[model samples]
Target: MTTAVITFSPQGLKVMQRIASHMAVDQYLHQAIAAPPGVTPFERVVALTGEIFSRYEGLVYVAPCGVVVRAIAPLVDSKLRDPAVVCLDVGARHAMSVLSGHEGGANDLAIAVANITGAEPVISTTTEAVKDLIVGIGCRKGKSAADIVTAVTTALAGLELPLERVRLLATADVKAQEAGLLEAAAQLNIPLRVIDSDLIRHSTRPFGHSEFVASHVQLPAVSEPAALLAGRRTSLLLQKTAFNGITVAIARENCPSLA
Candidate 1:
């Protein structure tokens, strides 16, 4: 989905530019969407917003809510088909998902934007409050996507959790190149978040470790700390389970504060 980040002022444009820089580097971590125009091409807010509503899948409006709402009022349509819209204050203090919070991907976009701008994300989606489950996975270098799906789905079933409850799939940064893991997440329609291995190894809570894993990844474990780090939880819903060549761990939390 293409993201159109529209700024109303020079300061807002500057902040959006900074966000664009991070987006470039993190493209692989998250699906890369088209970069927003460097500068706001249209001088008029209403015209720009109408054009965005017509053209983009996502909209990042770096301006006051009132301004954004007024500009896009005429374009408002059914939530089922409307584009996801996020509003960030010109000061970059808060990122709020203004429309299509879940199905349209606005909530995740708000969090992503907040991650870049150090802004507090105001996520009000009901599912976000209730469905905060993170699945952590680790596997051999050449595991198949089907193997990953089987391992993860079996774990979730044992825990009595539905797939829709999953908010993200996490793994160590070193495994960012792991094709099986990426394909599994893509198949399941879950966002894959890669956490730095240092942070995982230095986690406050002890994780299940192994000498073999240490020899390979320099860390005793991957899924546990990766899940804890991504979920911001102190405990796991399901301990590490290994089958064939894949390992899966489950973590649960209720919309923990973003890092």
Candidate 2:
């Protein structure tokens, strides 16, 4: 579905034109309608434009005035798929992403448009820290939940490790409680450990309980050990070239409580 940009003034048209020039022509559906001053509230213009594209999926509305902003308020709450609503002043001084940013890719798109139009991009969320390959592993609402579960299960098994041993499952904590890792875990009879930033920092092993603590826990070095255990369920075997008789094994164990 093409992203929709609705505007009322010639100045707004210029802003949309600049945005379109930078992006694919088919990506945007630009509607330049003339609204006379004091004839209709800005809100009514947004509502009317929204109603025209109500049946289409992935429609993003951008308006340039406060009155039009107020008019678009109701449409903001409507049950539409992939709706990205943004507003900018007629002068193209600032652009605000008011709704459906992260999942809808609005923030990124807004920044792109802002750069082209010389408007400020208002992004609030901080970027994800400790970069790793992020796999989207959950089912979205209004879709087949089982299909998602099956796909995740297949990916997990293909990794060649006991499913229970895979730690650091990333997802919304609350969503994890409902429709996240539980189904995949049950299907494979493996425990799925949910993790966030705090856990990722302290925990050495990404899988089941581990007792073996590395003498030093540092990056680049720690990544090697993690790579070794990526697909294996057992402890890693390390050999010392100097001492032929001595060998080192790293494994996860239960942590002892101070109490």
Candidate 3:
């Protein structure tokens, strides 16, 4: 899903630059401040937000939370239809999920941005205690978003687990910009993480091998290794499995039982 990052100050611009390096977002700055290359200037955030509110899937504010709230208050609609909104302070210490925390994916979007900015992610939407499940996926190029959703849902269903326990979706870096993967993550309201191909290729973690992948993509495997590599002290919960043209695997961070 497409996103826009907007800021009100020079300090915020610096934070925006850091975010741009890692995520794909259209950049915007206040009209009074001179914008760096590729960043657009807006006279008023409220007006601009109103105009583009429906165009983007997410809006990240590198400004005060109050200002962000005021600017978006008028455009605020339903959680299911509203764009994901996240706020980061100029110092970049916190990434807050301001709107659409569930249906529209602000919770996961904030986490993804926080991961990039090295900020703490703030999500208030209550669920069962967080679980560290990572779902790894691989798909044929140009697959539709449904293809990805099906693969992930099917994998999770086998365990009778809900989406809340899942932390993120992991895939090889080559699939970072895959349209299907991106939209599927947005649709599922789960963060999508891209593991570097070099890391996946060099990983010693024992997962099933795919001759088709070795011959075609030149990697030992994609799904299982991606899940294994995405979390800390992770162990495989599910091995690689094929769903039509997509492949899926599941991994969880190894923590002692609370029970």
Candidate 4:
């Protein structure tokens, strides 16, 4: 599905560009706001939204939730037919599924944006919110996508978990640009969260330390820390496991009731 990111303010435009830089998405900026090349500028949000409401499969608004709600209020229809709408703060702090959370693929889009921007995905769907599996991966440079997939699938299979249960695949931002990692995520149809190195370094949660990782990536550990930090109320369901040049860890996010 085609996606577009739109914003009104300069700060929001920066966030929009950050997302668009990683994902294959179009950009729409308010006419009054200045932007770099490749971003289409529009006169009014309401008019622009109407024009592209049906044109794109996904719409990410890098503005306040109220602004997005107001712009798309009139265009909302059935979830089956409407495009997925995600609301993101201008700071790129949270990606919320504002419309058609489940049926329209907004939930997935929210997670994808969050994964790319190191933002939190605000998914309110009961089933999704309660979801437990997070797979964190760390691989040597230039590993094949097939190798990464095989290692992840093997790790999940050891615990008899299905692929659908794996909501997020997280890795340090240092590995975020790896083509193999990105392709594995695309092949699995899951979001690959790129956690900042500083966040991992400063995380309160305890994880195993790897001297090699500390030397190269400047982090204590990659897979374990990434798994534990990706979601809310998380705990390590499975510790880091190695296969060939890849290391994988699994973390489970507890539901509110469970917590």
Candidate 5:
């Protein structure tokens, strides 16, 4: 998704710079800019916001909530069509999802911004408040889509979690182009996230490993690391399980309850 970060003061600009770097490291597409000198930044943000509302999926404004709300007022439409708008204090102490909290991803953006800037994210979305499950999978070179689906479903069933409880499916970067994996993700209606092999190895010690897989892929394991990386947690709810040439793992992260 495309994102834009606009700031008013120098402090906000500094925070925006940090946010940009963080987003880039996480492979997020983003644009960052400060308002021009001598002109009112709020006015510039307002003008640019009108265009960004349609052009970008997310908007980050580092200024007061009032300024952001007023600036985007004219372009405000239904939440379904509006871009996710996140407002941060000038000091970068708080990141607030002011509009389009769920469907537009403002709440998730807030949490990511908070992780980068060490600020508290103020997200009020109800669904976002619930913890999401991440499912990680590894399959044979030419596994069938049906086999992949069966492996994932069996893993979730072991944990007594329904398929709808899963929010994301992750696998090693090598599997990013796997037709079976992609097809299974499409059938399940969840995002298929690909993680770099090195990042996966460094994420956490694999719950299970195979010397054969290590020789071929140069990674200790695939499913366990993919789950930990996507869930941002160290432990797994279910360790690697192999069935019919498909391996699956499950992990959960505790999301902060809405206050």
Candidate 6:
């Protein structure tokens, strides 16, 4: 596994260096004093830092406050492909697991580093790590929106749920209009329903039901709306409309009551 340490302050850089040296893993360690152009310092760090460890399988890191850590948060959330993210205070007195700690060996690394540096390791991804159901899907690079829809459709079908009983769909609105999604819905005899953002906002039923399945499709930045909808029984379909990504949640209706 390769690790990239991004920091702006000299003191923070030194702390990262010590951790890297102590770990003694065959990892790439790179330091940047300044953020790149046209990007926030955080985004720059994530982009540059990501490149350094691209050749390796895993990533470990000590991100200090400032642009570097903030910008990388979303990218790490969306991309990074299961990379381990750990944050360190300026003096290396405390370490926190902010991302990918459980599955990516970040917890073990935190313990090791804490023992050596005498820093307290704070882990936050405990629930996700234990349950491990938050799966990420990546569309093939440079693939067309149509292709992405096909892939997602095929993947959803493999889950093997009855197409008619599904309801409660969620996704970016733009994906609701994609040719691939429409086609898949027609072929599968499902409804590609649109979700209103406000519903997902003020509702306690985020997960809807165990029978409910969610799909996220990428979309173009300007043409998407974050939306969610619930119904008693309706099949749901998701297709990627653009590059920004969308999430669809499908639920099965309860049996009709005859009073």
- Candidates' lDDT values, in order? 0.77, 0.41, 0.86, 0.90, 0.75, 0.43
Which parts of model 6 are misplaced by more than 4 Å? 25-43, 56-60, 65-69, 77-80, 127-259
lDDT of 3 by residue, 127-162 (tens): 512566899998888888998898899889998887
lDDT tens readout by residue for model 5, 95-185: 8999998888887677667656756567666664464788889887989788899889988987799887776788887787789998998
Best by TM-score: 4
lDDT (Cα, 0-100) at 65 in candidate 2: 44
Q: Each prediction's TM-score against the native?
A: 0.69, 0.38, 0.59, 0.88, 0.62, 0.38
lDDT of 2 by residue, 1-259 (tens): 3455556666666666666666542222233455433222244464565664455333334454465457556666543343655666657766676556656555545554554565655644333111122222322333333554555445544444343443323232222454434554454433222222233345465332222222222121222233233222323322111112111122222213211
Candidate 6 structure, TM-score to reference: 0.38
Q: Candidate 5: which stretches are off by over 4 Å?
A: 1-43, 55-74, 84-101, 105-124, 204-206, 254-259
What is the clash count of model 2? Answer: 11
Candidate 6 residues 102-217, lDDT tens each? 56666545545654455655654534222111111222224354554454454446566433333212233434455554454445433333443344334454332211122323
Number of the predicted model whose lDDT against the real structure is largest: 4
- In candidate 2, position 10 carries an lDDT of 68
- Assess candidate 1 and give its TM-score to the true structure: 0.69
How far does residue 113 in candidate 5 sit from its true spot (Å)? Answer: 13
* Error of model 2, residue 70, in angstroms: 2.2
Candidate 4 backbone collisions, by pair: none
Q: Give the C-alpha miss distance for residue 156 in model 2, angstroms.
A: 29
- Per-residue lDDT for 1-259 in model 1, tens only? 6787776566776677877776642111101223343343565778767755867778888878998899889998978888988999979878899998888888878867775675656777876656678888989999988899999999999988999988878888778779888889889877676676767677777778878789998987988887877754436888889978888888887445532
